[model samples]
Target chain A: MEKWRATSNLRRSLKSILNRQLSSVSEFRYLNEKRSCQSSFNLIRDCKSLGQVNAIQHRCFSSASTLVQRNPSFSTLNSDDISYFKGLLGEKSVIQDEDRLETVNTDWMHKYKGSSKLLLLPRSTEEVAQILRYCNSRCLAVVPQGGNTGLVGGSVPVFDEVIVNVSSMKNIISFDKVSGILVCEAGCILENLISFLDNQGFIMPLDLGAKGSCQIGGNVSTNAGGLRLVRYGSLHENVLGLEAVLANGDVLDMLGTLRKDNTGYDLKHLFIGSEGSLGIVTKVSILTPPKLSSVNIAFLACNDYSSCQKLLMEAKRKLGEILSAFEFLDTEAMNLVLHQFDGVRNPLPASMHNFYILIETTGSDESYNRYLY
Target chain B: MEKWRATSNLRRSLKSILNRQLSSVSEFRYLNEKRSCQSSFNLIRDCKSLGQVNAIQHRCFSSASTLVQRNPSFSTLNSDDISYFKGLLGEKSVIQDEDRLETVNTDWMHKYKGSSKLLLLPRSTEEVAQILRYCNSRCLAVVPQGGNTGLVGGSVPVFDEVIVNVSSMKNIISFDKVSGILVCEAGCILENLISFLDNQGFIMPLDLGAKGSCQIGGNVSTNAGGLRLVRYGSLHENVLGLEAVLANGDVLDMLGTLRKDNTGYDLKHLFIGSEGSLGIVTKVSILTPPKLSSVNIAFLACNDYSSCQKLLMEAKRKLGEILSAFEFLDTEAMNLVLHQFDGVRNPLPASMHNFYILIETTGSDESYNRYLY
Candidate 1:
């Protein structure tokens, strides 16, 4: 009975939160306001249980000034419940106060700087699921945030959505070194994952320049493409499985590391690049590559774009499967590189060409050198 | 008038092919006797005058016989068209015989074997477009065949569809060695493209086992994923732009090598893995990578999965950014390899561990020895 009473109180607060959020959506604002007003009629009918109902109402509408003068059954909050929740989760981890809220509100792109609101830092998936279930029942919008380095405006919230930052929920759940698969929290940074894999004599199959700040969750959301796509591929190939919380607060436990499993509709692919419009990814399983025996790199200079094309054809024939990276550089991009990097000069002479390319090839077979010779 | 008569005669032969193929389908077997009676009516209608009205009737009957009969409209193809597209770049390339038809019918999987009464090999994009326009107007179901290495039943015809094999369309249209971009014909073999680039000290950005047999068009159609995807990525990343013929026989000129273009919705992505359902990709513009100086390969045996994970973490932490392929091999797969390949021996001792990993790394910087140490 105590748990039921507490849940009912939570539901009332949640409904109020939903009403506030819906009131801002232009079309539904007036409808929700009318619905809130009509709740007084229901309160009048429940007057026999008025004492319990009034206590719940008081916890929600703490200030009389925020409420309208309505039916005799309607009651107002005295002033303690709001303060109690404002202090919840403060002991478990650092909660974002007004000062820290400013930075978390905006994404890397200044395009979407959401109005800073409550930042709930969850330490475990269960806590997140619980919070989501509570928020969901009350019609609250929950936004999951990570390293927040997305080019697309997906990591940031749009309205009065509750921000559930999973940065605190960091843990390496399991890793099968034989299969080269790692299961970790979504908040895990790509740099940390790479570093961890490197120690195991393996490396994350894919890489990018934003590796230092980009979280794996954000990477999975945008299906982020990077430099190593010339070799290791995009996130679509690297990510084996995921665990996500859907919009309705249903947990999707799709954690599988098998290479080939055609059980049914591939639900994982649908959520991968969904940008959180579909669900919030809590955990991830990724396939990593083992360390290589030997590697080689080369910077090639070409007379023209046609020369680069000719070079690729010849190199693939000679290099066979050993060809790894074949990155191209236009004259403008090469010039930019030369100017930006200290002591870095163009490999080609000024009279020679209009474009440049950086090529690297690696192989476990020694015969790769014989072809190079 | 002669061309129109030739089309009318072709339509008669096509109707017979459709009827024959329909009999082979298990679902349509019930409709077999009913379809046979209509063939005689098709023969008389197919022999009508070379007028536009008769051509329309010819198409209606042709589509009615095949599965998913999509009737071609008059606006798609005019009866007065008389244009001949010869060779590409002065190379006379055309083959129209039973022997050649049999050769291009079967793909690598041998699942999608085509039985085209007449096969037309077009040498260039212009020729292909012209052929499609002419056939499309007569309501002909045309199947576009490349190296025929497709896994799905995409490159082959299910019925009496005109088979347009782009085998003779092999030609290097443009090559920019500096930019590492190559524009080539659809029928160009992957191996030949690699060889052409290799001779000039460059290489194909991607590689696979069936390099010699697979065509660039086949690669683009299926969005091919291969071993090199552990590094270079799929055809979707490498291919910058494509030229294709839409279902309505309209040529979509989308050949450009720009990396970043936010002009509109990405239309090229739709055609990449559509398996030639939407359009026929005629020309391709791809970004190629530069050649590497050298490569290093290493094989490792891990005692346990956790130690393997630790080893990868250590290597990545110690190696910094210069790391590449780290392929994990289970003992089951390793034993299979040894059993399958005659005289093949395990790189590591059998008593040491349950799994082996092959690692390779490549870099252009001259100080490669320091990374190894």
Candidate 2:
């Protein structure tokens, strides 16, 4: 019963961490204000129970007020800037409410936090250009944010830099069935794009754990590599072209659909993986590969790393072109997954091996792949 | 006999253009001097036969002296620079022989030519750093050449910039079979690496017509995209890490083997497609995919573009993961290929279709794939 209670408390703490409830932030702020003289580290040290300590630590780390100071080079937000943003994007798009600003100010990992007074939600490339232009002229540094699912502290601001969210600009411009070329607004969520492509009998060149929240713009900006990269490759190869707005608000359109165009210096590559320092990517044109018919997955136990290595080599030689994914995990990782998820049982005996390998093969010939297995 | 004479004349002209024999440059120079007053346009008009016109046109275009003048900012090469290069890299490594310099001075396309007085071959990264450090101090511009197979005149010098060839630095540093990561010197030829990976039961993520001559460094610099990109993706996705020597001689070692490292900004990407403008890439660590066993190819005829589009959709839906390549060609392309290559016959009846589609599928199971087909 005591262990159950501890697990329940831990679940609640994890839930709070994952889902940013509006009440939790205010409750945390009120509790922090009441004990203004005591530091969060001291409070963590004083906690009697492990569950209570975990919850408190989670809350303390997530709030922006308890985080480090903002960079001084950037100017603080003023009423004029807020008014200008409202005039441009409307009052609803100009977010200033403290309750809603908490999530935007914090990152997915709760590692980086910013104290921005305003967030401008742009609905179009033109709007993004105008906002960036104003910010550049006013010496107001701005952070271009998408789904805020970046592992690095790239999506959040380091100082009083204005946050320009592109989520409202989600739109699918066009798709050529023959070429498997997709042109869409950058703010479109990756999962939505995947679903859309699935319906069209195609698949995106990349897939990741954060697909549900990560936007296509963020993926291109960071040059994200994911699970399917071992098979489909990276965005640089899949993305044929893109349209970006430079820092000075000049729109650079290199959005070409042709596969083999060697006209001039490939300037589109400069914007890719630049992380928004050079410009804000507003639209993307990407090539999607056709989905195959058969998929075979095998979960195997490996006695040692050498055996895993040998198995991978054998799989490569025998499987040839059908091998899609080859992923491995150590015993410690397996144990952690098993412990965290109640439904996930280990496939092999607990003491049988130290490594687990998961191999996936996809091809047009279902029977051939099955026979090989 | 007359047809044979015409063909032989055309071949000689083509050879002069493609081969870049030591005498071709001097012959082209002499021809240009003889026709100093006659414009190439006029010469083409004045020709008596098509074969004569072709040869004259080839000569007119291939002569570097007849082209635009070099950039004036770069200083002219002196005896001191040649001596310094010879001292750094032994006498054999420093090439000043006119006959040997012809191929190095001319590009693969034979479109651009450089009047470089000296070529320095560096065998190691340390030697590259030392050469660049001296060049920077002397205010002498430098061009880093690898395979000299670039299409954008990147590998060749624009003027008197010293050529630092890295072909001597072709060394396979290491390969981790477990992770399928191969590390090698930048100067390693792409085809050679492919063969090495083939022996290990793996395949490089990229393939191109220039693979036989293009170095891995050049491929990374140009971000070369080729035929297999539809299946394997691009270099940006496959390259995990690299080592680069900056303009000021700073050796930036970012060669990491781990799949995931999000500690800071991905600075290595800045060099992936920078075309050697940012720095000289000395080494690369890339992820190679495992080779599959079963392979199937089908040549289908399409009545129209719409039918080809529908067929592609169907192929993607049915093939799923095993679909490796889906290529299309028009009747004109088919006819050209058929006319150019002997023993190349059309897959379909001549009167049947306007378009041809080639689909290739690879998987682990041979019988399953064959049964599906």
Candidate 3:
């Protein structure tokens, strides 16, 4: 226990020292803006300090700036950066309203609060890339915001960083009916994408409860795993290719639709679930799934957990790959669901078992039903 | 275009020089056992040669390897290192059968060739960790191999390094029937797991075409995607917890059945699809599903790509989430399956359209099937 405590302390201390050193460097760069370009690269080059170096060596680590950067508190960006952004966006996109900023700073969870002085809303990937390039050159930190529906404080500023809101960039660039691939802007809402695909008779392979407000960009950032994970899968599987602007503003155009591309290391994955710490994803290309005609949902009450297991095995054997959902509603979860939701009823009596599985099976016709019956 | 060409040429030159330096260092390490404890981590630290330095710089410049580890050839370990590994294993389960090694090296596509000088098969996760610690201290690169049915060359050694074959480590540790979480060794075959679950009346939520030969470790290391990914999802989604040994021999024990864990960076994913460059996974905890009773399979021929896509969308609207498999088979893939496999008939006429779809609808009994059909 003593050794473990020491190890934890050492790790934290090292992290603090590294953050201090980084913040000092950032401050130095900000003060001497002329050398900011050269200094930013140096900081990236020395990132090993943040990841590897032990903290026990440095005693005065409390003053170190965290990896998350902040703009001067209570101060907005200079007219130069704002005008530069406005010049690229041609005016209507950037949001400077404090009320809107407050809303954007606090996400759906209401957990994280940001201090970003200004928020730039870009309408296109090119504009986004340009903005990032400008920010990188000036050694400015950026917070990439999507639908503002994130849970883990991602998509919101951790510090007083500039928020590059991609909400205005929502547009379905292209759709390949054959491959079921959808190419769209990063800010495209999940709900909109699903509806559009539904209208066209296709469906995005993945869905979640947050689909109503969550942006595809935010989803990709957290590699969002929701209920359909039992069926359609997570964002990592659905997202095919991404167009992201790196920290250095280099546009990584990994927009290929080929399922098998082993040209090099998969860079896109690093940004996925990175929470915009590494880069700003501007556009996304994802593999959508074909739609189904119907579904059959059964809320089953099992005698025991073993019975539930048996039930799944039987379904798999009889159903093959058609079983879409096999959700276990623990007794506690079931009680909570009943307590929280209106019009939702428990299918099984409380005294039956400790677990109740909500089994939902989907298919086109009566063949599946025959086996179940 | 000129700038791009120039950059590409510089990259190519840098790559060749780095490759040569690594090759020579590996050769030197092989000749002298004392130098065998080298890892990719050391390559970044002790690189004084221009070639080695340039390679490291190239990695830094790319923003590619910065997110992930650069690919390391398997020639870092020596024969003495293998002996040391044997000492760590206590000599009981190690296997060096050339025929077995040769078969295991070749993947499903026959693309990877394993040429390891030694093959150590550990029977338990503890043994695996011990061997890794010993090897890591000696700077030895250990290639982790299982039922090597990978589409990519992730399971095979890149050079003449020691191979830690996990075949002997197969065993079921524990299972929670209530939570539907199962813990097993990395070497457990997917089919065996399915069978075990079947006997118990539950099913592994995930399934793949390579279930017969592919081990869970291989599936995890490759983040394997399969047919059921359209439903139960890829290995990454189904995977709940893992026991992995890092490069430096530290064991990260994240074995649990918690649906929600916000502890820290999801370390499991870092090793998943890392191709054994980062660590070797020894055990896995996964969420299985309760069995379902039935499914409906449909083989449909569409007029065109758009029509096929439209058909899927219509089905999803009609079926909701019950549509499990909407496999879009390219004409080429369909023809290949039909020609190569017996009992696999073409669902559509070859000359009629550009593509064919095998859509399966899964659900409960006949009553539900009637509604779907």
Instruction: Choose the strongest candidate by TM-score.
Output: 2
Lowest-sum lDDT 10-residue window in model 2 chain B: B40-49
Model 3 CA lDDT for position B136: 57
CAPRI-style class, candidate 3: incorrect
| Candidate that beats the other on DockQ, 2 or 3, i.e. the better one | 2
Task: Estimate, for each residue in B45-95, the C-alpha lDDT of model 1 and write its tens digit.
Answer: 121111222233465565322333222221222223212323322223433
Instruction: In angstroms, give how far residue A365 of model 2 lies from its true place.
Output: 5.0
Predicted candidate 3 versus true structure: per-residue lDDT over B283-314, tens digit per residue: 99987766555667778887678888778767
> Could you arrange the candidates by lDDT from highest to lowest?
2, 3, 1
Report the backbone clash tally of model 1.
81
Q: What proportion of the true contacts does each candidate reproduce?
A: 0.01, 0.40, 0.10
Work out the TM-score per prediction.
0.52, 0.74, 0.66
Instruction: Report, to 2 decimal places, the DockQ of model 3.
Output: 0.11
Say what the RMSD of model 1 is. Answer: 17.0
Docking level of model 2: incorrect
Model 2: per-residue Cα lDDT over B1-373, one tens digit each: 3433332333233222212211221222233333321121112111111222233456555642343333333356677877888888889999888876777878788876667777888999999998877776665667788999877566876555678888998999999876789999999999999999989877787888899988998888777887666566566667888887765566767687755443223446556765675568999999887767678999999889989988877877676566778889998999899999999999677685789999988766666667656
lDDT (CA) per prediction: 0.59, 0.69, 0.63
Write candidate 2's Cα lDDT for A1-373 as tens digits: 3433332333333222212211222223223333321122111111111222233457555543343333233356688988898899999999989976788888899876766777889999999989877875665767788999987667776545678889998999999877799999999999999999989877888889999989999898888888776566567667888887755565667677766433323445545665665467899999887766678999999888989988878877676566778889998998899899989998776675789999898766676678768
Candidate 3 structure, TM-score to reference: 0.66
